[model samples]
Target: MKSEYLRITGGTPLEGTVRAAGAKNAITKLLV
Candidate 1:
């Protein structure tokens, strides 16, 4: 299977309170 990736963009400093939901069954790696 072909690999799929995500593109994210933002310009603000992340502050306080982060909520992550779903995406536990993915076979891709996330690089931050």
Candidate 2:
């Protein structure tokens, strides 16, 4: 089987002391 990939073309701007929290998984879980 062949795997397929999707592409997203865009730009994200983080301004004014933006930050990513410590755990990504925790963030994803929290988001859900």
For lDDT, the strongest prediction is 1
Off by over 4 Å in 1: 12-32
lDDT of 2 by residue, 1-32 (tens): 96433233458643453234556455445434
List, residue by residue over 1-32, the lDDT tens digit for candidate 1: 96544554588664564333555334223425
Identify the leading candidate in terms of TM-score: 2
lDDT of each: 0.46, 0.44
Q: Model 2 off-target regions past 4 Å?
A: 1-21
The true-versus-predicted C-alpha distance at residue 26 of model 2, in Å, is 0.3
TM-score of each: 0.24, 0.32
Weakest 10 consecutive residues of candidate 1 by summed lDDT: 22-31
State the number of backbone clashes in model 2.
0
